[model samples]
Target chain A: MKKLKRSARLVEMTQFLLARPHQLIPLTTFAQRYGAAKSSISEDLAIIKEVFEDEGTGELQTLAGAAGGVKYIPKMGREQALHFIEQLCEKLAEPNRILPGGYLYMSDLLGLPGLMNEAGKLFATAFAGRDIDCVMTVETKGIPLAYATGAELNLPVVLVRRDHQVTEGSAVSINYVSGSHKSLHTMSLSRRALKEKSKVLIVDDFMKAGGTIQGMVDLLAEFNAVVAGVGVLVESGEVETEQRLLRDYVSLATLRAVDAKGKEISVEPGNYFSRK
Target chain B: MKKLKRSARLVEMTQFLLARPHQLIPLTTFAQRYGAAKSSISEDLAIIKEVFEDEGTGELQTLAGAAGGVKYIPKMGREQALHFIEQLCEKLAEPNRILPGGYLYMSDLLGLPGLMNEAGKLFATAFAGRDIDCVMTVETKGIPLAYATGAELNLPVVLVRRDHQVTEGSAVSINYVSGSHKSLHTMSLSRRALKEKSKVLIVDDFMKAGGTIQGMVDLLAEFNAVVAGVGVLVESGEVETEQRLLRDYVSLATLRAVDAKGKEISVEPGNYFSRK
Candidate 1:
């Protein structure tokens, strides 16, 4: 394997840890893999730690004693976790989401945490070993899922605002089309929110046209940062374009919406978490 | 110290882990203090682990190695930590917070996260060993501070909404009159959100008339929960009545409203987070 630069190693580290939460890896392992000193690795961890805390997703822990290593645990409470899964079951039972025409009401599912937190966990689990700095999500509905994912990883969540707020000041803006709306929408990030070359896990509530996802990909590039991973809360199982994005794309819930008389539907877990 | 009940011990354990994170404790010691079996202590730790994971605070980690036991790390990242404080400072600095003469405008500062998070951490650091299950705040503005406090402890945030939302279902409401407002403002909590006998830490952005804090106390009575501690982001240094209600209070910044000339003001850290 080719040696990765410090920034690239940082992205890889974040992605690795996010993938397998609650499993600790010794600092020496990362140092060995990156061909960097343990102290340098520690410094990188500190930067990742700062950004994650700022964003509020998953957290990094320095374990003590021999055999101690870092681990990432998805932050899902007893009530909140049960509430989410129950809601998923309830939402899946809804006929509108299971249209006989094989179309799902994913917009509704995308906004629900019952399904979203799973996606967040799976994504975090997938990148558990890679150095992921922060989880980035675009504005509006994506915020909740983003927050949940960030919380699990003990990382801070940096929101990509669609419009500039006076409080956020001048922002770095990008343009993309809505898959559902097909109309163009702009996504922006506060210049102060994300630093150059930070490793980011890109997540969204749902992926339809994926224009927004593509826009985010471009935005990360503009900042000279790498896109460590891309995951979604919901994905339309039948979409061809979403399939072409990557061979390894993951989704929490796949809806095969069937629209007929009264509508019918089926729901299943996505491959993101299962891959691990 | 009096031997606390198993439930209280659990709450205390959770609260302790929530604060002074990343410090380890032996199972034998914890069991000895609580007068419970080692197995029971293990089970209590499990419950706390589940709770913290669910609430998104940090994590309760147990090590089985020869030198290992359990430790809590305030898992949320440094940015998450500092961002909240900066927010409070900025909000407290607002001009309207300036009172008549030399007094600072503080209404906005009362519920801000930057201040609240700092105050919350200060309290969390001090009461790291007490039994605190929830962080309670009165309606509207107080919610932010409450959420900040809850975040530090990895406790679930339950807001006392001012108006009932269909989303929250039926709620228990209370009325209060503060020095700032005479008309009774109502605070409500969904009956389903809080549990009876919970050890709660009552927190608010500001305490002026003491009416809002009193109303929160009354609401706690309705739930049969215990008040573990009380923390305020900023306290009116001039108020004697509000000062009397504090068991433990943390003030990131204090203000004494000035007269017309704006010449005199007093500010300092509250006793809550001071190193003994």
Candidate 2:
């Protein structure tokens, strides 16, 4: 790398920090990379930090002393999050989304990269400051959301398979009832997928009766891993409080109703706003 | 947004372009947002563009005329990509990753957000000029990679499920053989999941006999969609070339051999480098 002008250096520095979130970088490294002095690097970072703060994109935290440098903490502002969620609710409420058996069609929404990215940021913002070792989700539908959150938090994502696969080697399997009918189902996690006593954040696309999430929790106990927090894109509000298998989780939207016969659907912002 | 200093504006402009890849943003929009003249905004974009190109991060494409604006096309440099894939092969070569049936366990590597982001960029770069409407992959393992590529290309991702779910509504399913054993498998995609006659890019984590990928292609045919391109993280070099089901695909790494008894494994950079 050659020494660049201040304008080019600023552009490069911003891109560098954005690419590597949550990781600390020493000021000396940037100084040497740009062939500039430490003081000059500090001043450059200061300008970047102010713009980041003003835009509400994230935070650029600088630490003092020899061991410390700077870290980019990705965050979504409350107003931005609310605005995004409100639009998501409206999209989710479209009458055409109502399928048979009171189910809502959300695969299309989940498939949108931009929408998933924003959802991931919201979960990251909701779970920020926690000591989350990794993000966990079940196979299939929840995988994308899990990865989205993982990318935002700069954490590894551990997937729980619905059925055991030989490629995973040794694994722990558990059975739990799911859905309104309480049908028996099995979920498994690879033994090597998670470390013992690790603090894990659970995320999923949807939660109904909280059975699948509870299954995940019960499976985590086998490895002695702690549940740091749980976040879901949508939760079934129709489920009775007592019938729900788990509590103390965050949701971005609540599926209030799906009138299959009437071909109507209703969705609202989740408990996230009320909790705040 | 209020007017910002030149340095602050530069940082903000860089962030803005990075976030909305492939989406055109008019210079007038930025000019209005920053309360600056279009000339000033153009100068800021020029600085950002230079840094992006020099760093090999990507290209800032500027369009001319009334509806014209700037678009960011994310790309990974050839040298950087080669270095990354080489390191990925080394990681995949670890003996512990070799499973019982000569299969390599890649869930850990795929779980890594940083690694997947880079792989996505590589795929995006490989298929940059193609007319890709969406990214397609199978259930479970390939979803994250598909979403990653979709994120880089600013396209939607459609998942093919092994078993049809009621929530997905009406779907088109096809049966195909997979793995070296050539066992039959069923894969289905929701009819509503994709538009008719769409151009799609297919991506996956691994390809042995190319059965799974072939299955995805067969399923795509049912939707009247066109296969724009195909990409994979790793391909099995051990499989006879004649036995492979698909041709003309990009791979980052190649699995040469896996000695289960000796606990030894071999991997190398895939044809991605050779193709260049």
Error of 1 at A120 (Å): 4.0
Writing each residue's lDDT as its tens digit, candidate 1 over B103-214 gives: 3544223312234344555556555666777777654344445554565565655566666545354578877665545668777876766799988877776676566777
Candidate 2 residue pairs in clash (backbone atoms < 3 Å): none
State the displacement of the C-alpha of residue B263, model 2, in Å, after optimal TM-score superposition.
2.0
The CA lDDT at B209 in model 1 is: 54
Scored by lDDT, the top model is 2
Write candidate 2's Cα lDDT for B173-212 as tens digits: 8999886877888988889999999999999988998999
**How does the DockQ of candidate 2 come out?**
0.87
Q: Estimate each model's TM-score.
A: 0.46, 0.98
Error of 1 at B256 (Å): 12
- Complex DockQ per candidate: 0.06, 0.87
Residue ranges of candidate 1 with Cα displaced over 4 Å: A1-91, A95-119, A241-248, A258-265, B1-276
